[model samples]
Target chain A: MIKLAVPRGSIQKNVSEILADLSIDIPDYNRANRVYSYEFKNINDAIARSFAEKDIPIQVALGNYDLGIVTSWWADELLIKYPHLSIENLILFNDSVSKLYSTRSNDKLPLNDNLDEHIIVTEFPNITTDYLYANRTTNYRVFEAWGNPETWLNGDASIAILPEEKLTDNVKVIDSIYQGGLLLIGNKKNLKKIKESKLFKLLNEYKGLSSRSPFHFFDNKINDYVNNTKKIYSTRKQIRIAIPDGHAFRHTALALNNAGVEIKGYTDSEVIQGDLSNNVNMIINVMRPQDMPQAVSLGLYDIAITGRDWLKNFIYNYPTAPVFEMHDLKQSKYRIGAVVSKDLNVTNVNEAMEVWASQGIKKIRIASEYFGIADYFARNFIKSEYQIIPISGASEGFVPEDAEILVEGTETGATLEANNLEMKDLILESTNCIIGHKNLIDNVNPLIVDFINRFQ
Target chain B: MVDTLKKFQVIEQLFRDVLNANNFTEIRTNTVQPLNLYTSAGTLTPSMLHGTYSFLDWDGWSGERVVLRPDVTVPAAQWYLNNMEGQEAKLFYIEPVYRFIDDKNNREIWQCGTELIGISPETANEAIIKLVTELLGKLNLTTAIKVIITNKDNNLQVDNYDSLPDESIAKRLIKALGNIFDKHGFNYEFIDASQNKKFEYYTNYAFSVIANDTEILSGGRYDNLCEGLGGKKAYASGFAFNMNELIKLLSDEQ
Candidate 1:
């Protein structure tokens, strides 16, 4: 059977239409409530599954699927990092091209001269590394952010290499990396298998149609935009505070407001890297709470307000790291737990192990947004060989199929129950707290201390 | 697999015998090393750093990652700086280094290597080449080997032996290698070549001992490596024999 892997996000609709045009119809694809895996109705002995766009290349490269439809950038990202991956680009869909660029917060920090002190944050670290090496930038740390690398340009990071669309007006584009579009990639070893299958004919037809008339999905014009807007940057000695942007932003904003700390443009309803002109010594930057602890230890920030779970996760990986939760806001609390499907007929982890053993399952798959914590929980509690599948989101759908258990944080356990899953064990209770580098507490700046004391 | 391992042990024993005879102390560094040891030290190239098997351990919550030992020479220099600062030392190792190469089966390479720290480059280079030729002579593959020496300059093609510049370190090294081989009544060939991209740490020169077109041994003078790895400035040079290649060549011959 020809197993195919397809993307599940923004480009999913276009890819589904392409597949349909090639006479491969999987009705479940691109549906509102689509299942991960589906059987093709029109094609004999063929199946398809939807995965995260970034994960499509990895899954295909591992030979888990014979054929994969993914964005060429994701394919390039993987190839550039691990050049030996047995993946070949088969068909090019020139329509969905994305331009990647090297952008900076300001021209103040001369890139070449101050490279030792520069911090480059990006979603595509491999691509960023290639850019840095090509430019002879030997000294710099590239931190991989979950999303929105451009948001880090506000004093926390010196440079950001991400897509053109994500670039904010405050940042200036230094140079542009070539753009890549959607592609049909296949495993090199499985090419014979793919050619022998029914996909060979459909792919041939698609290639003929594409060559005759190049596919055009979107405008390919390069946006020659350069913003010279001067942004506020904190000196090395200035106190930088990183706060959450997504779910915890509202609560953190409320807490900061209630504590009588006025960060302009940052309110319960809205979050911003607002004008911190009033608080002359302090700079406020909004970023992923998951990224804050490490950023603080890297001296990118002096103090950060992030989840206790993230703080613990960071500490677990780097026991010697000088970042600690300085003050617990005691708000937005949740329980980090090991979750399993309700149909498993097991109440606790021990019972689940017994059930798994009875089912002859040798290795358990644990999925999590927090990989370190998942590894810790699996090692200490599971008592079985387990692999941690690091995921970004949609982790709830992993159980009963993709993963055997999910090490996830839940506020009410309502979301878990909604997905027909139940908490097997409580790993830890997490709450939003103020985490800071040890240097912040040791140096004891009176203004920083006074600001931190207000939270109490 | 058992037979191959026996051959490996035999090669290991010969290496130990020769290294010990040359006043080299056998040192084995940790199989698991901190990634910061390499990154903060700035000793490895970008390409070599990418090939390391680095991962966050169970306690790696602080975002610090560890790697399976990728290169032994750096660790050997680090060990000397930590333990024998300001002292000259001769060290050797018969260990496995983990690297992610194109060939998956060859990721775990068994290498027999030597490092001389706090010695002058000229002495260190001659001593290493002498030691390598001695070991190869012991293995009875002395006649089937070619020693290609190159410094920061000069590009010598594999087919052209006359391209190496005269009155250079390559010439001096080749002459030194020739004298060492001739004194032992051994058969060997010496050529010159360009700097290898793999030896980014090599500050002065690099040499490779090729047997049947396969580089079975390689290393060079990396004088700045000691200071680069957060240690005091000291001269260091080393070479490692690829036991996998040696075993394959021997097995094929047998």
Candidate 2:
């Protein structure tokens, strides 16, 4: 059953009207009381009403609610608060209530025509400050407002950013900027199902009704008090490191965490903690080089722990992002080498080529994670027919069992030793290396720096 | 073999004779074009764009761009807009189109199509459809020939065009009709302009011909094709045949 959490007050009425139009009847919605919970009789779903739209996101993120309809303003706030929450089904509704704009009248102040030199007042300092900075408008200052824009517009302030829809009779919009509209938030577990369900279509149709300029009419005095206290304790902490779940990555996580660093596994429990306050670092154990480019594009991991051999071969076609090597942990030492059956007479690389050439074995099948290494051998190795089969896991077991020969990366040769296969040739030796984004190298989180220092 | 060659020549001569009798002129054009030509026509999509064989020709130049043509329609429209000037033009081309497919396979498809620019919709539609019917009559096939009709506006759903975000509604309309054709046991799906043509200036009818579930011919009215290309709004209509697919279908029957 899908559990939905609806923001209380005006938004609740809008939600109820939309549900009614869809022929979805909700029971036990009290008209007088603000705190109301409703359940649909036909569908196995329940709705929880909360006054704070911001709290709706937190509840959904915590898996308390499967779905929630919150304004984009509140959704953005939640994204900042919990960056780990996967926000799927981000449908832009045409119905917009308001946008924050400058209303103060100053002949010299660039109010609407030229907002470059305007000083806008708003309680949302982070978003407003970030937006202005991104747009390259440096001459703007944010002031705290008590309630609505009407109160601030009537004041002596030269510029005040308020919701566009809520612009009063005393003020007019010189320039209108489109702020994002209402957002539908879903928990990670239900996101894929919600995307495929009819509920998604119903929500899309009702999106325009919920569209309105988001007003910032709340008291800013408390926000100012909180901001003042936050400024003093804004020191960078330990880097919060996230690792992919597995025995290998778990060992790496334990090693990093044991060295007095914050390391986490990318699972439900760790993502919910959402504490990047400590300088956070992420490590991905790449079993295959093909997975590295996609991992980097997702921007989930700050650094990936992989092999140089994989990086050199697999990253030939696509442009790779600049990476900084922190440490060569050398945990699982592997070599890109050829493996053959122990009974084979060919002992050396040159000897193996001579035997195959004399035997007229024009076509040869090789299995390996290193397709590039295999291709290199095929091109130079007496013009023999060859096909490289890429194996993901248990490549050593492929030789004399699933394949004639195998090209694989191995460390300690324990598995090869067990399989009774001998290494024919070693192309390159690889060790575990700590790599970081080049952009984040100079700005290395102090916590991450400390962790790297421990390795040294 | 010599007699067969003579017979093939006679068939070709007969086909050419019929086209001449109908006042149709055979035309051809270069199969390479600028990438923007497709994008500006509102028919360029990531899938179709990717399908076109492209290469960076930066031997002596600093910047490189894609180098092959995927569609003949866009180039044909450009030619009409440039050469015809203010007058009406009736042109046709039979050429091989290059497209990239999976497994390193490049589809070199032969297409025979016509384009009528700056003509009234009613006149253009009647002329093209009649031309197609006459062309099919020369084939002498025992299979039933079916013409599916759809309006460029109503069938294509132009209002939802912007919301689609990906392919043009006209492309989707063709794809949907293809699906319908597949379900109905038509070996080839013909996209009627009325059902799939998305360009806003297409103010008239479009159609496709199918036999044994295979689309043999397709044509449509493009009343706004000129206006979209920065030319004054002019009524346009045309149709084309998949010569290669048709040949394969006919040979397979034998």
Candidate 3:
């Protein structure tokens, strides 16, 4: 059975009208209705349910539905906010789409202003943050509001960001955060239900669809699903597993193959289309290892193969995040350690604190991509004042230029030495391992344990 | 937790007993099978293999891809094709079929189904429905159900764009399977599902026992499937009662 969430606001009428054209009808869908769902017929008919337009992306991403008729801008926002879900905009209802606009009291969204005093109210926080951060803008606290975000643009909140078409307030348009259309968006792993549905088949039946049609992502995935004749797993009950994209993907895939879990083309394909045993529905994908722990914790993925340092960094980052490492795959071994400028008079964190006291350094600046780890290490070890600076990458470039201390994971000290950096203290030794959510592990641990045993 | 496990055991045993009483011998097959067996059928229904617990079966990657058996029927068919070719087999199986719903939830579902191979068309259809009816009655579901029967001709004819459920032979067998089920005493509604249908495996007729907008039992006749897997051109029909769905029905009643 395919679960479909129909957008519930103004787009409701348009969607309902379009669905009517496709011969699928729903009654009292726009207004409140007592019925939770309506199905045209059993066995391949849609179980149409209603959800707010804003919530549809998350609902579909959570696998509550196979697909949703969500606006592209909201889909883009949720995609950014929850990157772990791998949400895809399958097809646009219309080629031309509306966009999210950043409207401010003044025409300028300052990149160099200390607007900690200012507030910004917007429905799309993640999109807005991405825009601000991309431009290196700072100091404006974001406040989330939906529908009439313009109403909150008076006192502390000087900026009102909303859908370009939705906003009628008197504010200057600064930028378009995202452009959108009514498209079919679904969780990548659970898309088989959508592909198998009459809805998808019906949508694809429209004219102008060609090999050159602008739907390579959806088309490729659909082709994969259609071609895999014997799917070993059923799409009805799903478990999406992720392998880290770089450095760890090959090792993880090898371990999975060794563990007797068959991921066809895991090590070869641009995208491996099917699962083991030849049937379908193993929702597995490759993602950056840095994103694995958070993705697993958020329930976006049931399990993931990630370096132990990433999990440690994530736990240090999100102390209350709901995830744990079930077993170590024992690959991609590395050590996260404290590294300092070669001129520092310290070989360890304790001595580094003493150096800070002797040199009368007021606050030690620790820079790392492992911000959480750096902060956690600072709280535990540094006796004097210290400020943890979060760096995106290039941990070696920071030491003497922007920071005095560096916390980073390294396999060899060649890069550190090349940059005139020396290891100060070892934080933890790490390896690639499988991590999963606390709530989800019980359901998938048996598979994980068995997969791990294949390596043994 | 203990209570749920006990309930699971009771439900499984109950299903096993029902299949046994119906003159069907239980068959056990491996949880894994060759990936090629499913694809060789050369049907659009191959998407059914979308998410198998598959891995390379040989060392360093060059090997037949294998998966934990997704559905018992295919493995059961391969078994019949290998061991009992040209022979009539009344087989029932109780096993767990794994499904990956997404990255989060996967079901290790216990499915109980019966396949009546080499049986006459009408006989196989009627017998399968009779068992399904009996099981529903046995379960004593608090909510009543509806069974919808859709003939395969109308099903395969609609949505010909995807060329499915069409075995390319004369009805081959099970031509009157729908007619036979129409005559059963149990109340059923017949619908023309030729447009936008989903029965990729059924050769002639498909039926679903639905309760509370959910399918409690469903199956179809795969007349040419045995032949596709190297068995004689025999008739086969079966249905599985999702134990979890059944328990959910009971739980809802409470």
Candidate 4:
């Protein structure tokens, strides 16, 4: 079932009417005063009433709900915080939303004044802060607001940032910071599903309902609910694990959970919410060799999983605290070997050596991903007679095309075979492995041990 | 007043004289290359990324890719695989290599080297040592040139250390050994059955020459290079001079 967040009160009625026009009957939404939640009778749709528009984006991003009808302003604001999440549908609400600005200064609001040193109070910090910063207005402070600009602006604070549509008769928009529009959004995965589902067609037909201009509004009811729940659940003992959303690390976490490990999974998005506070047990980071040493030095994760190639290239030169290989998952199949144009007459290493000796071939160029390996070959076997060309990816394609002989990683040799090349020699076969801090391995947590044991 | 040009002329003359006297030839190749060449070598691995530069070729027939030839051996071997018609050929080249490294190391290094393809092991070894020694002789450094040799058959059977997830520790250990050897003023040591370099291409003997803790020359017998390049069973051996290191050593002694 697709759960949706809809703004409560008047916006909720407007949404229900729009759904009704689309032949999606949402019953007793307005008549029933206690109806803060409603489900579609015909379609698999459930709507929870939210007093604040800001809650929709957060809910969709957190994967708590599948779909949401929210202002484009909020969607844009939330997307900046979670760039990985894509906006599903932009159903432009006919509502012309205006951004409101207020100043406590007795003098007229200075729209032209440099806002670099100004403090702007707003509950929507993500959007408002980014908008100001992106425009080169940096020195502004954002304070969370309880209800509206009036709540904060009328008090000690003079200036505030808020959605233009929320400007009421009591306050005026000194200048429209941005025009707020309506947007439909879902979780990235759910958005894919929604696009394939029949509901997408129904929503498109009723897009005209998006024409209504948004009314001045402000609500902190959702934030209050979430904060209170968080406080109550503070004792629950949440353990965080940072994993790239789609990497194998995330799968490993699931496998651990299935094996009875109670750990909370967090993506790059959720990391900024707060410190893991001794709760983060592991991080599975993937990057090239140059990044591994730095990542290890950060000391954020008790344990990390990365490639050995990274360890050798960077860590060998720079010493860091010792790390241990907990388990070798044997993934990311990497093989370092040489491949040449199929037409080359040489068939063995000996032949290649003789060619170097008698042919007056003073310099031989080998293309490979392994510079150290190439260096080793150049220094030892080829007697430093040839130049080793270091490449980062697609080493096989270099043969006869860009390079004479290519030294690269191969798994099934399908890429080489596809390119009409064959492996002349087999260098080494490798797979992804899991590693951890040396101290952590000794004081090994049961969860980590269990996770590592899976590979064993 | 002409001393500086004469010195530059001497350096150039020394390089040419050594190549001509050793029966070495020269070749010029591209400076920029594809990214996968180094990634596949198992030597540079992902960790030694400090010396290589990469860029995406958005306009070329090939899609976007990273480039900058970090070393010259691979490019020369690549040339042999494409141009050489038979299993037996002798070639030599002197070129500049670009590597990205931290500290005050030179990004561009001059490599004076030779490659012996389709040759016997004994002949290849003789050629490698002869070329290296000749190059050293041209520089006429006061320090002794020592060749430390190890056979691939004698080392541990581990393959491709660079691709390992925790390769840094092992690589560090090896580098430490190099440092230890340098500190003790040892000429050379044959690495026993337990120690093996990360590249998988060496099937025979491998060696590097060090002077004052700096690697002045390195070479080995790669009998498998021909077979790896889809050629007849052939033996290959060669050595390269760190022209930069050689120059430094020469200048330091003066």
Candidate 5:
């Protein structure tokens, strides 16, 4: 039996059209509330599943699926990090194309300074790391982000790897690394066996797609929309604080206002980056909560307001990192745990392991945004061979299909219930908290101390 | 299974007999070591560092990564600093070293190795070469040893090596090795280091004992390793026999 993995989200419609051309009909593929798995009605003894585009190469490399469709850049990212993964039969779709750009802050290009002195944030952490290592730029701290690379291009990140569309006038493009497009990849062993199969024949026939009009992201480029209009004057002793800009924004804004630690332009409706106080030493920047832990650990920021789950993940991955939680904001409470499909009748991790064992599953796949936590969970609870599938987001749809269990965080159990997944074990109960470096916590600026005191 | 185990025991016993007769003490380091021990500058090559099998420990909430012993040389230096610094010691180990060779999966190789620490450069180099040749001869395998000489000035290549300007450590090592090999009646050759440059943290000299183009053993002088591992400057040289390669060669002879 041949198993295929396809991508979901923005490129889903384009992939759907390709599947239609190949006469591979997968049901509910382009719908918002669609299940991840499906059967190929036209092909016998074949099935397909949907996953996040970044996750396709990983699934194929793990041999979980015999065939996969993913972007070439994602495949290259995986291959660059792990060159030994057996992914063969790569057929690039010429119509879909984008370029990854290494950009630098136009404001802070100190020519004599080393690359490690600059902060580089990217969604493609692996690719950025490979680029740095290839250039012999050691001693660097590259932080991972969920999305919105442009938002960090202003002050928080001095360098970034993003698409041309996400570029801003405030940054200069250094070099373009990978020119990527949608492509089909297959497991090395399985591809050899299926070369004479119908699926392989169909995919091989479409390899010469150079005649198709390329779908270029640069053609209809976005205007410079995410510019840092209000720049804080550079200061030697300025204290930088990173605040969350996504789900925790409103709660963080409320907590700041309650503490009377007010920035002029920061409110529930809008967040600001600049001096939070008229004082010269106080500076604030807005970025993803997930990037805060590493940023604080790297001393790029004096302190940051982020979720405890993110802090725990950073601590788990780098136990020697000097970042520690200074105070808990006591908002945006959630529980991070192992979630499995309720149909499996597994109330805990041990039960899930037993059921998987009975099914003759050798290596259980655990999906999570926090792989460190998932690895910790699998090692402690699941006494069996397991693999942690590091995903970007939308982890709720993983269980019972792409993954057997999900190490996820949920504010309420409603989302898990709606997705037919239940919390099998709670690993951590977390809330929004402030994190600071262990070395500088005692020597923080007085204004930052006032900000933390207000949360009390 | 029993035959394979017997062959392994025989090969190990041969190594122990040779090393023990040379007054080398046997010591085993931990199978797991902290990642930082190998990542400090000048400790490992970038390629070797990339091949380490590192993961967070159970109490890794504090952010330290532990690696399955990738190379015994670094840990040997670490072991010296931890236990017996500022002392002369001949240490040997029969331990497995884990590395990811062009793959993500852990590949464990059993290496029977020895290190001569806190000794002079020329003495340590000659002693190691003599010991390796003796071990090979005892195992009934006549081996050809290639001593790779690296000079700071890349332009220097000498047939005699003594007339090649400056009393550099490489020149001294070549003269010392030549004298020892001639006295011991050992088969050996001195080759240019640049021809097959695999100088990873080796300051002066390196050697490889090859049989039928397969490297059965290799090692070098790494004086910087001890200082890199937070110890004072100490001269050290070590070599490890690829136990698997030796066993294969032994079985083929049988």
Candidate 6:
């Protein structure tokens, strides 16, 4: 299947025109209220998805899509990070004539001097990493942004790399990366057929499309890094703790409040990095509880607070993994259970199996983000083998349509009740708990242990 | 360093037993080879060369650099061309190949599969598909495997290894190969080579075996790879199972 991706925002209109000129049209290209993606009914057999400008390059690189149209800056950004991903630069469609340059408010940061004390903020961390490397400056901490680069110049940062067009009148250009524009990148997986196909060759010869490709070497002062030089972290005499973000944030805040540990800059902020007491260094960073198990076991974080259910799910798959559950905070309580339609008489695993067997369903479909939990549950409860269809969210919605049962983390059971799904098997109860690396308990300082004791 | 060697051994032995039944002799090639051979064969890229563990020629062979063989196919081709001399030969091998996977991780790959040299197109097609299917069956996969076949003639180009004149020969070969696939009752789908090409040296067909949405075994026909390497023109076909993938899948199943 031909899967193509286009950047959703900003450059959408320009690319829509370029695609139109090439006789490859996407429906509702110019409509302001148009949906994120469209499938062309024209002779071309393709499925196109509209992704965030930065995500387009990664989607194309991972071979999820055959082709992607993204800014050259993002393409260069991902290439610098993942050089081995098979992405071929097909042709440059349009030149936005925008150079990725660093801007300053009033005091322009010197290029050659020790940027050691300065804060370098950018939306493109990999590109900033390259810029710092090429300039031979390592004494700066890069502050990654979720949005608004200009707002950063007024605050903690002195320099921010934004597009020339996006820069404000108050911001002055200090340095520039190479000029980049719209680039057509093909996946390495699709290279075999797409690059060699005669039809693709004809499509590459589109009129009004600029022949100049921005993906090339630079001879100018904006030099490229010979190799990627990642900043080495100096060993600090501080403990690292990761607090779960998103749904678990409120519970985490409440738990910290009760424990008398001051974690500043968490509430009313999307900040990933925050500061905590000196007992725990680097403040308290936020990450998904789902990712906490692997991260803590890898010793990236000395301590983490996540759901015991999540840890249970991890141990279900990898029992020998090095994860130590230190304390159960009794926060963010939830139940891991299977839910089916309320209309059905099924109330338990054996009853669900009976219904599935009576219906002569050979392979029962179960949906869950926790595939290991679902698979283990299905295998143990049902004598017949079942197919576990993974879902990211809204596991209850799939119960009546795509799946017969949904194995989900049920909190309050309101959403399940609203969806007309009845709780079947109460798999396990879960709550936010303190976890540490079994092999790295010594790394946790005494102050951190005392703090955990208060919570227990 | 990988603890999955036991899993590799199980799959490798199954492949050994299957290929032995088909009268293909198991052979071992050198762990290291001349870097020039791969370059001369028009298969080596600068990136691949940079990834290879090559050094100053200590063997006193006129400063010719050597590397730990990046793939079993090249060494297999060189061996066939040197010994067989265009004679029909069927060989299978299970060995470690070194290549660039990424910057941070180890590049050593455990490759195990069959290599056919100086064989007819019809015979090679039947042998290659059967061997790959047999290996997949031996893995005892939880689900049925799907084979995505790239038509040999769909990507006719002026590549270094093209020995055929008209495209009609590739057409007939495709039909013959399709028949062989049909006879085995293999679940297969056709995709053009222009969409998903693997090796630079593949001139005819390339196919990948997928189960659980993961590509486990991949290989294709390199009809003129021997001739491109300055050997006598001979038809060759081979397939290799990434033994690590087999081990991972089997481990999860067990």
Best by lDDT: 1
DockQ measured for candidate 5? 0.12
Best by DockQ: 1
**Model 1 agreement with the true structure over A1-456: per-residue lDDT tens digits:** 888888888889888878877887888885788367888888878888888888778768767688898877788888877788899877776643667877776534422222233567788877766555444343356678887777777655667777767777777776776576778888999898887788756866775214212222132111222123222443355577887888777777667778887666665464555334246677777888888887787666778999899888877766777788888888888999999999997889889988988999988988788877888888788787888877766665678766789999998988888889999899999988888888866688777788789987
Select the stronger candidate by TM-score from 2 and 4. Answer: 2
Give the worst 10-residue stretch by lDDT in candidate 1 chain A: A217-226
**CAPRI band for model 5:** incorrect
Query: What is the lDDT for A91 in model 5?
Result: 71
Error of 1 at B104 (Å): 5.2
What's the residue-level lDDT of A108 in candidate 2? 25
Predicted candidate 4 versus true structure: per-residue lDDT over A213-234, tens digit per residue? 3323233222222123211111
State each model's TM-score restricted to chain B: 0.85, 0.70, 0.77, 0.71, 0.79, 0.77
Residue A109 error, candidate 6, Å:
19
Stretches of candidate 2 exceeding 4 Å from the true structure: A1-244, A254-260, A264-277, A280-290, A297-302, A317-331, A348-362, A369-385, A436-456, B1-108, B112-206, B209-216, B221-238, B245-254
RMSD of 4: 27.9
Worst 10 residues of 2 chain A by lDDT: A225-234
**TM-score of each model, in listed order:** 0.80, 0.41, 0.39, 0.32, 0.74, 0.44
| Model 4 alpha-carbon drift over 4 Å, by segment | A1-456, B1-12, B40-44, B58-66, B144-147, B156-200, B226-233, B251-254
Candidate 3 lDDT by residue in tens digits, A52-79 = 5766776577565777887676777766
lDDT (10s digit) by residue, model 6, range A161-204: 78777676767766766677788888877887776654355458
What docking tier does model 3 reach?
A: incorrect
TM-score of chain A, model number 4:
0.40
Ranking by lDDT: 1, 5, 6, 3, 2, 4
How far is B215's C-alpha from truth in model 1 (Å)? 2.8
> All models, DockQ values?
0.22, 0.02, 0.01, 0.01, 0.12, 0.02
- Model 5 over residues A168-195: C-alpha lDDT tens digits? 6767776665566778888987866667
lDDT of 6 by residue, B24-71 (tens): 988889887876566567565444544666643333111234678887
Local error of candidate 1 at residue A407 (angstroms): 2.1
Q: Rank the models by TM-score, top first.
A: 1, 5, 6, 2, 3, 4
